[model samples]
Target: MNARALGLLLGYGADRLLGDPQRGHPVAGFGTWALACERQLYAPSRTRGTCFVVVTTAPWVGLAVLATHLPASRTLVTAAFTWAALGGRSLEREALPVHELLFEGELEGARQRIRSLVGRDTSALEAPDLARAVVESLAENQSDAVAATLVWGALAGSPGIVLHRCVNTLDAMVGHRSERYADFGWAAARLDDVLNWLPARVSLLATAAVVGATDGTSAARRVLTGASRDGARHPSPNAGPVEAAAAYALGVQLGGLTTYGDRVEDRGQLGDGRPVSVRDIRRAATLTRQVGLVVLGAAVTATAMGGRLRRR
Candidate 1:
């Protein structure tokens, strides 16, 4: 209704229509710079990493502020920024190929296809594990790619969204468990976790609400149970809720016993029964879209309600 909500809608519509930049998204540019910075500034301690996080991400906030000065270009900038921040179509585009490969019973093809989506060793993954990983990624990325961005876009407009994207890109570039980056990536990883914290919960609730509407399941109990039983096993505070809710939504078990690197560990189960499948992967993709829509809808309502109250 208002310009802000309309701008946000147009931005999300852009994602649905345009997907990602085929060649040069701004986030890609940031990623390249971040990698260069890591190579030049990396140290075996957290202090440098902490400073790197701030130094690298702070400029985007400034850029965002500068963009605000061009009132004539405000809507265009916001729409473009939010479009870049949201990745609904690309997320499904990546996930579906894995499903198609798995559905064709081309296990090797599926493995190769999945590499584009996840960083995990696919050599050992069976079809089910591959599907499970896709579903998990879809859920977590729903938080990171859609909900987190939309939340920030609504709360602080373009600058906040840009800043959040910068932090996320930094984490992707350097955050990991490897010795070279374990210490140096601490700040990037932690900041990403902090930013995604509330958004992750919102994503989980959005996912579980969809499931409840479709299956008559109790969104609260299932989400809570899945979170409690399986959440503790996950390494991320934010990822746990998103992945757990997705598992419950699909009525499929995820996590369980799995191999990671050189270690084999039981991550326990998240949902009720059965391993994930191609069908579940499709469902997860649909659920990802639903979650994004829910976030957008909520934002519109909140903005409209706030505007009304302000007038009163």
Candidate 2:
């Protein structure tokens, strides 16, 4: 296998086995640095936000470029970055506990646990709403944290993955519709939208492909139908389709009124079937794993083909 492809697989394997590092995670460290920079760089101006992005992300991305150029260090660096960038296992770990809490009828515990997974308010959520939150987070994050990371890593090696993660992190930090961030987060939000566009599609299709492979064509059609009907109605260009796909794949409804602090959004109806239940969360987790496997196989196959073509 090519070094890039090998590194990608190694990193994915490590993530599967180890989850994220317990301490000193590079992404966590980056978050700290970015927060410090934001204090000094904060402004309502888009220009200032743009500078913040450059200052925070450029150094790391530049280092990736340099390290990737070294034959001896390329694969190791790519593997390390890929492991840092992907969060599928952590997504599962965090999500399933909410399921456990809900299963045990610990509504308050579920609500508290769910706060770690979603930005939406959880204190008043009932079981159905709590289930929806976890499922929705799983669906959206499957693309944002896993598929996108793999796509960029395959396409541009270490620098591509790092850039995508940085932009995404910045978006998560500042991309808000609130008065405080509407202007300052514009660039990060826009850049995140652009970078995630293709990855979201890939995730949507991968979800359908897995469903079709296991459950046959009729089941898969639901995945496509859900996206076609409701994907555009949601606010995020990337997340809407992915969540819609998951909603159908698991045969549950998602996306309705969501509360983030004082803000309320009508996320639109995403799928057909009964309202989401705690059981659906487990199903969503399984579907996420299947989708990740499919993406991994596809990336490795594509990389191998490209390497062969170059040699020939």
Candidate 3:
């Protein structure tokens, strides 16, 4: 019932659910539902206008009712489901397949796979571009999927987490500037921007804390300052800080030319480190895991303190 116990349960449950084919992979279900809802609810113009009001309003009302009557175990189960559902497919393992394809000199194959995971073109990308894309995706997703869900779950329980995931899922499915989604995805995009506002900064701070702890306090301070100045330069509002911090912590350069379908987007670079490489991608993953652990620990601690205060 306490935050720490709840956070541990949620975190442990997420790890256990990973690679679980029997449940059809938990994150996949979340993505499926989200995509389905967007296709159904927003694809129609009349419905799209009311999407935000409907989605946000319904969940809080439902959660209020559930909180009043639901048993603790049931609430926890719901929370666990929300965590897995929001994460989508396990990109952590999926990244390895991409690495292997690139490792074998399968440029075409790697590019094809990369298309599914990112909005950019991988066909013309060299090794450094490929590595940068992977690292960027990993860093951004750490805030969007992992850190955001975990923090919401700890603070507000299952329904709160589920609501956050729904916003995120909707954004991913329909939120883009492409002609097909421009109007319909507007609500989802705005909502995602609002939801991610705090979590994004929290994620950057968490990354800085971990880097400082692992490297040194001075290194952490430099990374934080770099992120504060350079993070906003990235196209996404929330992704900049985490990516900037990671680039600084790992001593790698990120951001450059990114090709989308037929257009190329040249983003400003974040860190002053070396160009990306395969080793950098792997190191980024390692750093992601390390930050995840630290965030989990902090969530648990905060939850414990809350329980004590309530008892008093």
Candidate 4:
């Protein structure tokens, strides 16, 4: 494999083995910068949001561009980006803790742990309901946080990964529909959706493939079809497919009544199996890891093919 692929592979290993470093997380730093920008630039308009995105993303993009040019810096830069941007380890850390807390019958602990994983209100959730929420978040984010990074890292090395993370960060920070940010966050939300579009579909197939590998199925299409039905109910164009696949794969149902800060959203339903359980939390993390492996494998294959094409 080429340096880029090698770097990504190493980076994946680092994230899997080490998660993220305890201090100086690049995303956290970017978060601070982004919040500051938003404070100074916030308005109920798209123009200001657009400007916020540009201002926040420009520095990272420029540094990535510079990093790509130095042959000596390529491996280190790619590895660094992979470590920082891809969130498989972080996702696992956040996810499995809920299962642990739940398994111990610590509903209060589980609720708090669940909060670390999703934006929804966890205060009143029963054990099963909380498990469903964790599974849903893990599955959806498996695409957004893990698979998408690998995809973008393979496509454009550090620059692609960096920019994608920036977009995703913006969405998490400002893309929600609060009264203060409804219109202002519109652009950020849409950009995140568009960037995530292909990756989310890829995530569905990846999840289905994992299911097929273990279930003795030959055709992915059949599994995908069932998963598709599950995904169709979600409001997000991208999250629906992956979360639906997770629900199907995990033998559980997700989506029902979800509470945020104060509002309750009835997001219909997905899947048709057992109710959520603590085990599904571990299952969801395992599934995301498997998908991450698949994404990395694809990246390696693509890098190898690109090398051959260049020779041709």
Candidate 5:
């Protein structure tokens, strides 16, 4: 298959897998699997830890890809693996539900849900802060979770995608600064950063392109330039552009303080427009959907061109 055809196929496969409730619900299982793999492979020595995690996860990703070559069952396996790797409970869905509680003035319920979704204390968060946190998470995850995964899957096929998922899972599991993973998880964290580096930028550009097409090329240029100038300020190398582009496209501020455990991190903000609100959060989702469609269309066009060339 050509790049575009593969991309379209991958996108359709991902959408179908994500939309299916039975398959989608198992996302947590994938998370659990990744965590389990991390714990099993986590050696005390940094070198040993890195080797163990890489060796273990690589094969699993490869196996997942190989399974895609199977007959009629390949699609089901691919769908299951994708759902497990990428379909789990997201901050986006969780955020809205929590927001609803808060909107009804149920502060305590919102606080509880927020605590569950994020690792930080939410006792002191106001409604706006809660909304901001949700929006930022949604924006960042567009690169980390959705876009990156789809691109990886498209390029590398199922195995490549599975491998990406495994690395991401490892990063999420042990990538944080805590007593347990501070040293050992370093390799996994760095690897995840490296893997996501290009894809993140591509996702930002894709978002910019879509915005420019739907809005104006000037708006897209502004978003891209602003992202390039300011994205590196965020803690993550890959997360900045996605968050920045989303904020710019939606015309709202994102980023700032995020708490983890007892420590509070002051992250650089993206965009200087209005403060984030539920409407903005919804708009971000809409943008994500639009970006997905853009990607799908591009892939389809590319695939068709390739087919024509082959025929010629």
Candidate 6:
């Protein structure tokens, strides 16, 4: 394997084993700095939003570019960047506790724990709604945190990986329909959509492959068919496909009345299967892990093949 592939695989292993560092994570630091920048840069204008994105994200990308250029430390630098960017294990860690809380019949505890995973109002959510929220967040975040990070890393090396993660962070921070962000967050939201476009489809494909391997072709076909039919209907262009695919792959319906703060959204159903229950939470987590492994394998194979072809 070349430096890129080897670094990515090692970083992936590190993530699987150690997960993200508990304190002073690079991503967290970036978010803090970005928030400060946003305080100064926030304006109800798309142009200002564009500038905020460039100002906050460019430095990290440039630093990544510089870091990867050190021949002596190239692999180590790349691995570090990959490890910092990917959050597959952290995503699962945040999600499974909600499952555990539900399994123990602690509805209030589950609701409180789920707040870490979703932005929705969990206080009033019952068991089924809580399960749906966990499943949806898992499916969508699998694409955002795992698929997109790997795809950008494979395509553009360290800088690409950093850039994707930075843009995604900005989107999550301010990308919303609220009055405060509707205009100011346009650039981050659109760029995230563009950056995530391929990754989301890759996520769907990964879901299909994993489901097919585990549950046979019919289930895989359901994932694809459901996504094709209902994916575009959701507000987010990228999230819809992956979430829909995951819903069908797990044989559970998702997307319904979701409350975010005072905003109420009736996201139409995705799959035709039964309403998601507490049990499907673990199933979804397993499916996400399998999908991530599939993505990792594909990324490694592609990077390795490309490396060989370039040599030829």
Q: How close to the true structure is residue 259 of candidate 5, measured as C-alpha lDDT? A: 79
* lDDT (Cα, tens digit) per residue for candidate 1, span 28-82: 8888878777777878899999988887887878988898778666677878889
Compose the digit string of candidate 5's lDDT tens values, residues 7-106: 4455456654454365444445666666666666676667866875677586676677567776755545644554455532353566678768867888
lDDT for 260 in candidate 3 is 77
After TM-score superposition, what is the CA distance of residue 182 in candidate 2 from its true location, in Å?
0.5
Ten-residue region with minimum lDDT total, candidate 4: 216-225
Predictions ranked by lDDT, top down? 6, 2, 4, 1, 3, 5
lDDT of 6 by residue, 1-312 (tens): 888988888888899999999998999999999999999998999999999999999999999988887766677877888898889999999999999989999999999988889999988999999999999999999999999988888999999999999999999998898899999999999999999999999999999999899789987888898897888778888888898998889878988778999999877788888999999988999999999999999998999899999999
Q: After superposition, how far is residue 272 of candidate 3 from its true place, in Å?
A: 0.8
Tens digit per residue, CA lDDT, model 3, 1-312: 564456455654666365335466644565665565555565535357357436544654375347535565654564455445444236566566677787888877877887756777676887778878988988888788777776776676566666777677667767777777777777777878888877788788888998888789999899999998888888888888888988998999887767778766766788999988877767787788777667666766776777788899
What is the Å distance of residue 64 in model 3 from its true position?
9.2
Q: What does the lDDT come to for candidate 1?
A: 0.82
- Residue-level lDDT of model 2, residues 153-208, one tens digit each, is 88888999999999999999999888988989999999999999999998998999
Q: Record all residue pairs in model 6 with backbone atoms less than 3 Å apart, i.e. clashing.
A: none
lDDT of 4 by residue, 96-155 (tens): 888888898999988887777899988888898888888888888888888888888888
TM-score of each: 0.93, 0.98, 0.87, 0.96, 0.85, 0.98
Candidate 2 structure, TM-score to reference: 0.98
Report the number of backbone clashes for model 2.
0
